[model samples]
Target: MEYTFDQAAALLNMGRNTLIRRLREEGMLGTDNLPTSRWRGRGVFRVITKMYRHPVAGYIHYGRTVITVKGLNAVSRKLRLAQHQPEGSRNRASWVN
Candidate 1:
Protein backbone atom coordinates (compact mmCIF):
# COMPACT_ATOMS: atom_id res chain seq x y z
CA MET A 1 0.00 0.00 0.00
CA GLU A 2 1.03 3.58 -0.65
CA TYR A 3 0.29 6.62 1.48
CA THR A 4 0.30 10.24 0.46
CA PHE A 5 2.68 12.68 2.12
CA ASP A 6 -0.09 14.22 4.21
CA GLN A 7 -1.35 10.81 5.30
CA ALA A 8 2.14 9.66 6.20
CA ALA A 9 2.77 12.80 8.24
CA ALA A 10 -0.51 12.38 10.05
CA LEU A 11 0.25 8.76 10.81
CA LEU A 12 3.67 9.72 12.13
CA ASN A 13 2.30 12.65 14.16
CA MET A 14 4.32 15.33 12.37
CA GLY A 15 3.79 18.25 10.02
CA ARG A 16 3.89 17.66 6.29
CA ASN A 17 6.76 20.07 5.64
CA THR A 18 8.74 18.58 8.50
CA LEU A 19 8.19 15.11 7.11
CA ILE A 20 9.33 16.22 3.64
CA ARG A 21 12.42 17.89 5.07
CA ARG A 22 13.31 14.81 7.10
CA LEU A 23 12.76 12.54 4.12
CA ARG A 24 15.19 14.62 2.07
CA GLU A 25 17.83 15.01 4.79
CA GLU A 26 17.44 11.82 6.80
CA GLY A 27 15.78 9.45 4.31
CA MET A 28 13.05 8.72 6.87
CA LEU A 29 9.75 10.27 7.86
CA GLY A 30 8.98 9.63 11.53
CA THR A 31 10.20 12.17 14.08
CA ASP A 32 10.36 10.13 17.29
CA ASN A 33 11.97 7.12 15.68
CA LEU A 34 15.70 7.00 15.15
CA PRO A 35 15.96 5.74 11.60
CA THR A 36 17.61 2.39 11.19
CA SER A 37 20.85 2.22 9.21
CA ARG A 38 18.97 0.82 6.24
CA TRP A 39 16.50 3.69 6.21
CA ARG A 40 19.14 6.36 6.66
CA GLY A 41 21.21 5.16 3.76
CA ARG A 42 18.64 5.60 1.00
CA GLY A 43 15.39 7.35 0.16
CA VAL A 44 12.15 5.39 0.55
CA PHE A 45 9.30 7.39 -0.92
CA ARG A 46 8.52 7.53 -4.65
CA VAL A 47 6.90 10.39 -6.50
CA ILE A 48 3.89 9.85 -8.78
CA THR A 49 2.48 12.44 -11.11
CA LYS A 50 -0.82 12.75 -12.96
CA MET A 51 -1.88 15.05 -15.74
CA TYR A 52 -5.43 16.20 -16.11
CA ARG A 53 -7.27 18.69 -18.28
CA HIS A 54 -9.96 21.03 -17.02
CA PRO A 55 -12.73 22.68 -19.01
CA VAL A 56 -11.46 26.16 -18.29
CA ALA A 57 -7.73 25.43 -18.17
CA GLY A 58 -5.32 23.37 -20.25
CA TYR A 59 -3.49 20.29 -19.04
CA ILE A 60 -2.04 20.48 -15.57
CA HIS A 61 0.28 18.06 -13.96
CA TYR A 62 0.68 17.41 -10.23
CA GLY A 63 2.93 15.06 -8.34
CA ARG A 64 2.46 13.31 -5.02
CA THR A 65 5.05 11.37 -3.09
CA VAL A 66 4.04 8.10 -1.45
CA ILE A 67 5.46 5.82 1.23
CA THR A 68 5.07 2.09 1.43
CA VAL A 69 3.21 0.27 4.23
CA LYS A 70 6.31 -1.71 5.08
CA GLY A 71 8.32 1.50 5.48
CA LEU A 72 5.70 2.94 7.79
CA ASN A 73 5.63 -0.23 9.86
CA ALA A 74 9.39 -0.22 10.27
CA VAL A 75 9.31 3.40 11.44
CA SER A 76 6.50 2.63 13.83
CA ARG A 77 8.35 -0.30 15.33
CA LYS A 78 11.46 1.81 15.83
CA LEU A 79 9.41 4.49 17.52
CA ARG A 80 7.92 1.96 19.91
CA LEU A 81 11.36 0.70 20.76
CA ALA A 82 12.64 4.20 21.33
CA GLN A 83 9.75 5.01 23.62
CA HIS A 84 10.39 1.91 25.71
CA GLN A 85 14.11 2.40 26.33
CA PRO A 86 15.35 4.48 29.23
CA GLU A 87 17.32 7.65 28.66
CA GLY A 88 20.86 7.04 27.34
CA SER A 89 20.27 3.30 27.22
CA ARG A 90 21.64 1.12 24.43
CA ASN A 91 19.83 -2.15 25.11
CA ARG A 92 16.92 -2.08 22.68
CA ALA A 93 15.91 -5.63 23.47
CA SER A 94 15.65 -4.93 27.18
CA TRP A 95 12.15 -3.59 26.74
CA VAL A 96 10.91 -6.37 24.50
CA ASN A 97 10.23 -8.77 27.35
Candidate 2:
Protein backbone atom coordinates (compact mmCIF):
# COMPACT_ATOMS: atom_id res chain seq x y z
CA MET A 1 0.00 0.00 0.00
CA GLU A 2 1.06 3.55 -0.61
CA TYR A 3 1.91 5.59 2.47
CA THR A 4 2.34 9.27 2.97
CA PHE A 5 5.71 10.61 4.07
CA ASP A 6 4.47 10.92 7.64
CA GLN A 7 3.47 7.27 7.71
CA ALA A 8 6.65 6.17 5.99
CA ALA A 9 8.77 8.17 8.40
CA ALA A 10 6.94 6.63 11.34
CA LEU A 11 7.47 3.16 9.97
CA LEU A 12 11.14 3.94 9.40
CA ASN A 13 11.49 5.39 12.92
CA MET A 14 12.43 8.81 11.59
CA GLY A 15 11.09 12.33 11.60
CA ARG A 16 9.35 13.43 8.40
CA ASN A 17 11.57 16.46 8.00
CA THR A 18 14.64 14.37 8.63
CA LEU A 19 13.57 11.88 6.03
CA ILE A 20 13.02 14.69 3.55
CA ARG A 21 16.37 16.24 4.41
CA ARG A 22 18.12 12.95 3.96
CA LEU A 23 16.48 12.44 0.62
CA ARG A 24 17.48 15.96 -0.37
CA GLU A 25 21.06 15.28 0.58
CA GLU A 26 20.99 12.09 -1.41
CA GLY A 27 19.71 13.96 -4.47
CA MET A 28 16.57 11.89 -4.57
CA LEU A 29 14.33 14.81 -3.80
CA GLY A 30 14.18 18.45 -4.71
CA THR A 31 13.85 21.34 -2.25
CA ASP A 32 10.08 21.06 -2.65
CA ASN A 33 10.34 17.35 -1.78
CA LEU A 34 9.37 16.00 -5.17
CA PRO A 35 11.38 13.02 -6.22
CA THR A 36 13.90 13.52 -8.97
CA SER A 37 13.50 11.60 -12.23
CA ARG A 38 16.10 9.08 -11.21
CA TRP A 39 14.09 7.99 -8.21
CA ARG A 40 10.59 8.67 -9.42
CA GLY A 41 9.18 5.31 -10.33
CA ARG A 42 6.55 2.72 -9.57
CA GLY A 43 8.62 0.98 -6.92
CA VAL A 44 9.43 4.17 -5.10
CA PHE A 45 6.68 6.74 -5.32
CA ARG A 46 3.26 7.79 -6.52
CA VAL A 47 2.35 11.41 -7.03
CA ILE A 48 -1.22 12.59 -6.69
CA THR A 49 -2.29 15.83 -8.25
CA LYS A 50 -5.54 17.46 -7.27
CA MET A 51 -7.26 20.31 -8.97
CA TYR A 52 -8.70 22.69 -6.47
CA ARG A 53 -11.27 25.25 -7.41
CA HIS A 54 -10.35 28.79 -6.53
CA PRO A 55 -12.50 31.88 -6.24
CA VAL A 56 -10.61 33.92 -8.82
CA ALA A 57 -8.07 31.47 -10.22
CA GLY A 58 -10.73 28.98 -11.36
CA TYR A 59 -8.51 26.02 -10.61
CA ILE A 60 -5.11 25.26 -9.19
CA HIS A 61 -3.24 22.03 -9.13
CA TYR A 62 -1.73 20.74 -5.90
CA GLY A 63 0.07 17.51 -5.39
CA ARG A 64 1.44 15.13 -2.81
CA THR A 65 3.98 12.33 -2.95
CA VAL A 66 3.28 8.99 -1.35
CA ILE A 67 5.75 6.24 -0.72
CA THR A 68 5.20 2.66 -1.74
CA VAL A 69 6.07 -0.19 0.64
CA LYS A 70 9.02 -0.85 -1.59
CA GLY A 71 9.95 2.81 -1.44
CA LEU A 72 9.93 2.78 2.34
CA ASN A 73 12.22 -0.22 2.38
CA ALA A 74 14.44 1.34 -0.26
CA VAL A 75 14.76 4.51 1.77
CA SER A 76 15.58 2.55 4.90
CA ARG A 77 18.30 0.64 3.12
CA LYS A 78 19.72 3.76 1.51
CA LEU A 79 19.84 5.59 4.79
CA ARG A 80 21.64 2.69 6.44
CA LEU A 81 24.18 2.63 3.63
CA ALA A 82 24.60 6.38 3.84
CA GLN A 83 25.39 6.23 7.55
CA HIS A 84 28.53 4.24 6.78
CA GLN A 85 29.70 6.58 3.99
CA PRO A 86 31.54 9.83 4.40
CA GLU A 87 29.73 13.15 4.18
CA GLY A 88 30.00 15.93 1.51
CA SER A 89 30.14 13.43 -1.31
CA ARG A 90 26.47 12.56 -1.33
CA ASN A 91 25.26 16.10 -1.06
CA ARG A 92 25.83 16.80 -4.75
CA ALA A 93 22.87 16.73 -7.11
CA SER A 94 22.46 13.50 -9.08
CA TRP A 95 21.39 14.79 -12.41
CA VAL A 96 20.04 12.60 -15.17
CA ASN A 97 22.92 11.70 -17.35
Please give, for residues 42-81, the per-residue lDDT of candidate 2 as tens digits.
5677888889899999999877888875676577777873
74 Cα displacement, candidate 1 (Å): 4.9
lDDT by residue (tens digit), candidate 1, 30-55: 44333435564344455577889988
What TM-score does candidate 2 reach? 0.76
Q: Please list the Cα RMSD from the true structure of every candidate, rounded to 1 decimal place.
A: 9.5, 10.1
TM per model? 0.47, 0.76
lDDT of 1 at 12: 80
Error of 1 at 96 (Å): 14
Q: Clash pairs of candidate 1?
A: none
Output the number of the TM-score-best candidate. Answer: 2
> Residue 36 deviation, candidate 2, in Å?
0.3
Clashes of each: 0, 0
